[model samples]
Target: MAQTGWDDGQALIPPDMYTDWTAVALLLLTAAPLAIVVGTAGFFIWKQKRSSQR
Candidate 1:
């Protein structure tokens, strides 16, 4: 008889699920500043409208 050392079994992950981390990170970076710029502009516009109404 011969010994095969050990067996670790099959992998848990499926083969079709791949991710592109670089693109995800780049998207997050771009979204954060764009969100801030749009939010600031909206706030100032709202303030201007409020002050004009008084």
Candidate 2:
């Protein structure tokens, strides 16, 4: 028999699992917008409070 070069212990992702990446990407996409909106609101509120304290 010819030598099969790959090691038996190597890890590989099968093609069917590729869709899992898309699901994760969608989750991040949803989270990013929410985070941006919350951050912006918090920054504005902080600035308003700081200016009012003078």
Candidate 3:
């Protein structure tokens, strides 16, 4: 079997270029619930105002 080596001639990215995927995942998870709460509250408030005006 031939031993394969990295192509050193190619440009390489810095390690930090790979941003923390875990943090992104956590943020998305947290945002879902928060968005649901805000949306639900706004919906109820709008409904109440609409009914009162009718």
Candidate 4:
């Protein structure tokens, strides 16, 4: 962001979560486990409902 460091919030190539690879990797690594847990819970809920229906 050397190009727009002085500006407030708009940068052509800012190293934030959207465009920066390092930041994106950090975010994915942090959120992957939570995402897996959410998916597992959803699958279990679906299985439980299906079993009850049958």
Cα error of candidate 1 at position 7, Å: 27
How high is the lDDT of residue 34 in model 1? Answer: 100
**Total clashing residue pairs per candidate?**
0, 0, 0, 0
Model 3 Cα lDDT, one tens digit per residue, 1-54:
562343454547643367789999999999999999999999999999999999
Better of 1 and 4 by TM-score: 1
* Candidate 4: stretches off by over 4 Å: 1-21
- Worst lDDT run of 10 residues, candidate 1, spans 3-12
Please provide, for model 2 over 1-54, each residue's C-alpha lDDT reduced to its tens digit, 9 standing for 90 to 100.
674444344647543444678889999999999999999999999999999999
**Model 1 error, position 47 (Å):** 0.5
TM-score of each: 0.69, 0.62, 0.67, 0.55
Q: What C-alpha lDDT do the candidate models reach, one value each?
A: 0.82, 0.81, 0.82, 0.81
How far residue 26's Cα lies from its native spot in candidate 1, in Å, is: 0.3
Native-referenced Cα lDDT, model 4: 0.81
Candidate 1 residue spans exceeding 4 A from truth: 1-14
Give the Å shift of residue 33 in candidate 3: 0.7
Q: Give the TM-score (vs. native) of candidate 1.
A: 0.69
Q: Please provide, for model 4 over 1-54, each residue's C-alpha lDDT reduced to its tens digit, 9 standing for 90 to 100.
A: 366453566655555526568888999998999999999999999999999998
